[model samples]
Structures are given as C-alpha cells and as structure tokens.
Target: MRAIFFDETDAQAVVARLRADGFEAALERERLAGEDDDEDHPWAVVSDAPAFMLEVLVDTHDGWLDEGDDDAGEHTTPLAPLDLPTAPRTVKRPDLG
Candidate 1:
C-alpha cells in the first residue's frame, strides 16, 4: 500500500528502518515547502509489506499497522488511480477471466 508520512525529520531514518525490516521502501521528498533538499524534509513511501510501521511526525512518534488489534489479518493491494475532480471517470475493466 502507498503510505504518506508527514514528519520533520529526514525520511532516511524510517526508510532505513523499513529496509532493515525486510520491506521494499523508498524515500522521496515533497516539494511543498521548498526545503526538499534539506535532510529534514517531508517524505512519502510506498511499501508492499503489511507489517506495522514506525514514524516520527511533527507532533508525535509512533508505529502502527493498518489493521487493528483484532488481528483478523491485513493485506496489501495496488492503489487505485484517483479520478479527476471535474469528471466521473470510468474504471477500466480488467481481464480477470
């Protein structure tokens, strides 16, 4: 699943942690604050692992998974493309048969 993390620290820490945890992760800076080049920049990541993730946000630090404590189970799937704001776009049918 695609996850967006907003924090004041460089995403390298989290990226490294995720990699160590055997996840396919990457860190990319956001261009919103014109401080992307700095070590402390806002970043996002897309990971295939469904395990819990730790992040230090501007307000607090914590680790959490999409699934709750119930532990029914969690699965990762591709993110759907967002539709345009001005139109109701059609979802292409896939050849699943």
Candidate 2:
C-alpha cells in the first residue's frame, strides 16, 4: 500500500508510527508527471499496514492513498494444464541400452 503526502514530516511521522506498530513501512519521493518542480515532489509512505490504518493517517496528513491498479484486488484464474503424450517415449529406439 502507498500513501502520498505533500509534507515530508507527515510522511515520516506515518512511517514511524507504522514501524512502531510492527508493520513494514518506508518513505520515498513521489514524482508526478508534468510536475516540473523537483523539490515539490510529494513524499510517499510505502507500507504493509492495514488499509484502515493508512486511511486514517492519510486523512490527518492531508494526503491520499494511491491504490495502484484497479484490477489488483480481483482474483485471477490459474494457468491451464498442458497436454502430454499417452505413454513415456523409449530412449534411443531401445537399442543403445
């Protein structure tokens, strides 16, 4: 999960809290396309914290959650089985043995 914050302090705070609570968390720079200002890039809190926990933090920090890929939460079908020969083939026409 990812949460974006305009304030670096807020992003750091959230990461600290998540770590204290025993969840994997880290901070990074989030660059949005068309944003020419290099210093204006937002800070992102990347974490394995629960959605509810991150949602509350995002609300308090004036940021939003970037829930990546709409289809990411959906289930995917398993791979199809492969076809095989009815019997094992003989090795070297059974003459090398």
Candidate 3:
C-alpha cells in the first residue's frame, strides 16, 4: 500500500477524483491501534495545510476491485494484499552437502 501525502484541504477532492478515475483511494480518519487521538489527526480526514495531501493506495491485483460489476457501492470482492518487496537479510551459509 502506498500512502501519498497531499495537502489537507484537497484530500477529499483528490480522493473523489481518484475514485472517479477507477483508482483505489481512501481517507484514513483514525489510527487502528486504539491510541489516543492526537491533534495530528485531521478532523475531516482532510488537511488544510499549505497543500492538499492524498494517500493513494494502489491495488496489487484486480481482485481488490469488485469484479468490475456495475453495482454501485457493492463491494463484494475481498481486498487483495498489496505487493511488497521482501526485506533483505544476510544468512550465513553452512557447509555444502
């Protein structure tokens, strides 16, 4: 998932635009960890900073979308996992067989 930060003011507009353009976009209003809400959280999930910021989460697969059915607001398909690159780690090699 990619989080593209945009100016707070245009967050909603951007999200709407992306949705219209057949892209996966959403406004993150709260932290899922159940922590105390901080001042950083935008009241409307949109910012009013110098510029509007948007977090664009690209779909890893077409499955994330609802099979392209024409039903409005009918999200039946499950959200697919985002493609992520494997972390790089060094492993010591033992004696070869």
Candidate 4:
C-alpha cells in the first residue's frame, strides 16, 4: 500500500502514527522530473498495512492513497554508453642526461 502527501510534516506524522499502531510504514520524498525546487517535492508513505486500515487512516487525514503494485509509478530510464579505454597503456620514460 502507498499514499502520497503534499506536506512532509503530515507524511511523517502519518508514518509515526502507523508505527505506533504496529504497522510497517516507511516515508519517502519524491521529486518528479522538471521540478527544480525542493518545495515542489511530495512525500510518500509505503506500508504493508491492510486495505481497511489504510483507507481509514487516509480518510482521517484527507490524503490521496494509491493502491497497486509496489513498483507502481516508478520510472526507469536507459543508461547511455560511455567511451573509454578498455586496456592499460604504457608510457616511455624520458632520459635525464
């Protein structure tokens, strides 16, 4: 289960509450692409809590909850190739005469 909150404080508070209730909850900060400011980022709550409990908690806090696969909403991008030397090179020593 997962939820997103626009406020960090609220997210943390929820996480605390869930922990107090014996739920395995974790908080994370998410910043989407093209968002340059830290204030624009949102906080996320991930938990192994049941649907009923999650629903109640989210409803009580007026938060948006997204229930789906654990990896849902995660973005993946391909890595670019880099050009570099694959073998060691030897350098000749200069005479000091």
Ranking by lDDT: 2, 4, 1, 3
Best by TM-score: 2
Give the winner by TM-score: 2 or 4: 2
Candidate 3 local Cα displacement, residue 47, angstroms: 17
lDDT of each: 0.52, 0.91, 0.41, 0.82
Cα-based TM-score, every candidate: 0.38, 0.71, 0.29, 0.63
Order the candidate numbers by TM-score, best to worst: 2, 4, 1, 3
Residue-wise C-alpha lDDT for candidate 2, range 1-97, written one tens digit per residue = 8999999999999999999999999999998999999999999898989999999999998999999873455556656898989999977866766
Q: lDDT per residue, candidate 4, 1-97, as tens digits?
A: 7888887878888899889999899998876679999988888899988878878877877788886565753655546888889998877678843
In the predicted model 1, the residue pairs found to clash are none
Model 2, position 30: C-alpha lDDT score: 90
For model 1, residues 1-97, the per-residue Cα lDDT tens digits are 4344556243465666668889887766545555655655446655655544443321133322233332233445547898668867778768853
How big is the positional error of residue 80 in model 1, measured in Å on the Cα after superposition?
16
Expressed as tens digits, the lDDT of each residue in 11-64 for candidate 3 is 465566657656566666434355575645442232222121232221211111
Residue range with the least summed lDDT across 10 consecutive positions in model 2: 70-79
